[model samples]
Target: MKQPLLTTDFLDRAVDLFADDVGIVAEDGTEYTYGEVGDRVNRLSNALRERGVEKGDRVALLSKNSHYFIETLYATTQLGALFVPLNFRLQPEEYDYLVGDSDPDVFITDAEHAGTVTHLQDEGGVDEWICYDADDAEAGQWDDYEAVLEAASPDQPERPDISEDDDATILYTSGTTGDPKGVVHTHRTQHYHAMVHAHHVEFEDDDVLLWTSPMFHINGWGHIYGLTGIGGKHVIVRDFDPQTVFERIVEHDVSFLGGAPTVLNFLLEHNEEHDVETTGANPVRVETAASPPPKRTIRRTEDELGWRIIHAYGATETGPLITTSNSPRRIQDGDKYDIVNKPGFATINTEVRVVDEDGNDVPCDDETKGEVIARGNQILDRYWNKPEATEEAFTDRVEGWFHTGDIATMDANKMLTIVDRKKDVIISGGENISSIEVQDVLYDHPDVRLAAVIGVPHEKWGETPKALVVPHDGADLTEEEIIEFTRDRLAHYKCPTSVEFREDLPQTSTGKIQKFELREDYWNDDEDRRVN
Candidate 1:
C-alpha cells in the first residue's frame, strides 16, 4: 500500500491541487501558475529527451535565482537524470574542474551567467548547451531556452521508471583541499528530507517565500521541494539587497524566508540606518544557517525586526537540515534567544551526538565541547565518484555516523550549542578558546556592525585570538576599547589579543563570511603555526 517517495511527487501534487495558483514569481516580476509551470517543465523535459538525455545522464545548470531554475530542476529529475546546479558566483576558471567531473549530457545557463561557462562548453565534455535568454548570451550554437520549450509538445513527457533510491542530484561543496567534492543525494533522501523540513518549518499553501537565498544552495535549503509541495508561492531575488528584500517581502506578502547569519546582519544594519519596514500582511520568520550567528544578532532580529528566528544547522553532505531550534515547547520554557540562537536539538528522524576523539559522548554540562556527528535519512548517500573521500568522511571519530566537523556542547536539555568549527578553535597555551564565543561578545557592542574572530600567531600563547571588526557607519572604535569590551563579558584567555577595524568582510554568495580566506592570510604552509 506504500507509494514510492520521490521528489517528483512535490511538483506533481502542486500541479494537481494548486495548478491554477500563482506558484512562482520570477526574478523579473513575472508570475506563473502551477499549471503553466508544470507545462513548461514537461516541455523542457521533452526537449531534453529529444536531445538524448536519458536516465543516469547528468544535466548541469549554471544560473542565479530564477523560475526556470526550478523548471530545470524538476524537468531533469523527471526523466531520472541527475541535475547538477553549479554555484553561479564561481569564477569562469573554477568551472573547469566542476564541469569535467560531472560531465553532464547537457549544460544549461542563464543568460546573465552564460558567459561564465561558455568558454568551457567545447572542451568541457558537455554534449549540449541550452541558454536561457539566448539572445543576450554569447553567440554560439546554444539553443534558446524558451524556444526549446515552445517547439516541444506541451503534453507530459514520458517519465522513466524511477526508484526512490536512484541518484537524483549532485551538489558540489568547496573542499578543504583539492577539487570541490560532489555530494550525492538520492530520490528518497531529498523526498524524505523535504517532508521533514516542511513539518518543522510549518510551511502551508497560504505561505509565501522570498528567495533571499540562492536555489543552488542545497536546493534552496530544500525548500524548492517542501514549499512547492505544500503549494506555496516563490518570489525570486537574484541579487540580494536589503532594500529589495524589504520591498519584496511586503510586496509579495512573504511569510517565510531563509538566509545565512551574514545576510541577517546586513539586513539589520540596513534597517538600523534606513529604518525600512520589516513585515507585511503576514508575520515573517527567518531560517538562518550557513554559520552560527552571534547571539546578539538573533536577539536583534527578534527585537528589532519583530520577526521570529528559526535557527538550524547542517551541511551539504548531511541533508543540510539534521538539526534545528524551532521547538515551540522549548521556546515556552526557555529564554527566547537562548533556544533559537543555538542549534537546539536533532530534527525529527535525525540523530546528533557530540563525541570526543575516542567516540565517547560528552557530558551535557554546556561547558564541555566535542565534535558533532549526525545520523539521518537526509545524510548524503555518497560523494560522487569519490569513494575514498566518502569513506574518510564517515570513519573519522565514529565508525558509521557522518562527521560534521563542528565542535559543540549539548546542554542538560540536549540542546547542542556549536562552539566553533573543529579547525577554527583557538588553543592558546593549552587552553581552548571558542572563536564563536569571542565573536558573539563583540556583536553585543552597539557600534560593531560585523565581526569575525580568528586565531593568529602569538609569541607567548602559541596562538592567540584576533578580532576583525566592521564598525557602524560613523562610529569610531579603538583596539583597546574593543579589547575591554570583550574582557568585560568573556574570559581573559578568550578575548581578542588584537583588534583590526575594517569597512567590510568577505562573504560567500549566500552571505556567509569566508573565514578560511581570512585564515589563509595569517597562516600559510606553517603546519607549526596553527592553534590546532
Candidate 2:
C-alpha cells in the first residue's frame, strides 16, 4: 500500500512486459530490444557500482541522443545515483562550470565531446571519465563504456532501498537567463510526471515515438519515462534534421514527437522543398511548445504534413509538462484549432493558476493576464545547492505554487493561453505589450520565416518593441514593410517601433530563441533592464 514510486518502474515494466519488442532505434541504425536494453542497463549499473559510484553520487552525462544516452539514464538512476545531463552544445568553459557545480563522481560522454571532457577533468577535477565511443588507446585514462559493460556481470544489481523523495536526477536549466541552475527531480516526481504525461499524450505500447526534443532537455519532456512506461519504441536522433526526422518517422512509423515551433517551421519548409511523405495509416502526432506556433502553422502541420498538433506549456522546473491542449473528441473540427492553440487545462494531478502580482488568482474571463503558477506532484522542490534561488522560485505569497514566470490568461474552460514570458513583455509608455502578440502578427507575413520580438530601450517609452525577422529564402523584405505589416494588424504602441533583419535568430540548444541574448545589446546600459 505504501510502495515508493521510482522512474525505474518504467524500465522494469518494459523488460517484463515487452522483452522481445524493439525499444530503441539509435542514430547509427542499431536497434535494441527491451530485454537487451534492460540487460545493458543492468550491466551499466553494475559497472558504475564497481567503479565506486554509490547512491546519491552525481553521474554526469554529456552526449548527443543515442541508445548509450538512454541506457545511461536508466542505469545511473537504478543505482540511486543522481543523473546530471550536460548540454552538449555548451562550450568547454560552460562544461567546467556545470561539472564543478554538480561535482559528479563519474562523467560519461561520447567521442564528440572528448575534448570538453578532457578539459573538465584537467580543470574542473572531474573524478572519473567514461567515454562511450573511445578506442582502447583513446580511453587509456578513461573507462571505455562498452568495455566496462562487457567486463561487468549482466545480473541486475540488488535494488537499493530508494525512497520516493530520493534524488534521481539533476537537470540543469538552459542558462538562457543566467548561469544554469540545476533543477533536481526525485524519483516520485519523475514517475508521477511520466504517468500524467502518458495519460495526456495517449501513449500506448504500439506507438513508436521519435526523439525530436533533446534528451538533455527535461528528459525529452518526460518521454524517456512516459513512452518507456507504456513500452513504446523510441527512435533516437543525435540532432534535429528536417529530412532525417521525416525519414525516421516513416521508417519507424513514429506515432508522436515533440519540438519547439521553430522545429515545426523547419519541417514544413523541408516538406515544401522535398515533399517528404508523412501520410500513413498512423498520423504522426506533433507536440509543439517553447512558444506557441501561430494557428496557421498548426493548421499547416495537420493539412500539409498530415500530423496532429498538440500544444503544451511548461518549463524545466515543472517536470517540463504542466499543461497540454488535448481536446475532446466531440468538439467540432472547426473549433479544434482554438483548443490546440491554447496551452489548455492543467494535466491530471496538477494545479495551474494565473495569478496577479499579489498572488491572487486572475479571473478566467480570458482577458485578464497574470503570471502562471503551478503545483503538482511532479514539480521540482528546489534548485540543487542554491537555496536562495529555490526560495525566490517559490514565493511566500503562494505556499505550494511554483512561480512559472510566464504571463498568461485563462479562459472560462480553464484553458491557458501564454501571452509572453514575464521578462519578454514589452512595457511601452506604461502599457504592457505581449511580445508574443507582436510576433504572432509578424508570423502572418508571407515573407517572414522566423520572427522574434524583444523590448529595446527607447528614450521616449522606456522600452519599445523591436522585431527581428528572418525572411524566407530569395525574399527581399524591407524593415519598413515588416513594421507597416504589424502596424496594420496591431495597436501602434504594441507594434514594433523598429525592425531588424537577420538570416537567423540566436537560439538555445533546444531551438528556443534566446530573446535575452537579443535584448542585451539594446538594454546594456539601461537601468530598467530586467535580469532574471
lDDT scores in order: 0.90, 0.86
The deviation in Å at residue 509 for candidate 1 is 2.0
Q: Compared with the true structure, what per-residue lDDT tens digits does model 1 show for residues 61-170? A: 99889998999999999999999999988889999889889999999997888888878766847888999889998656689999999999989987999999999999
Q: Model 2 compared with the native: what TM-score?
A: 0.97
Model 1 steric clash pairs: none
Instruction: Give the clashing residue pairs of candidate 2, or none.
Output: none
Point out where model 1 deviates above 4 Å. 527-532
TM per prediction = 0.97, 0.97
Question: Which ten residues in a row are the worst by lDDT in model 1?
Answer: 523-532
Which TM-score value belongs to model 1? 0.97
**Model 2 ranges off by over 4 Å:** 136-140, 527-532
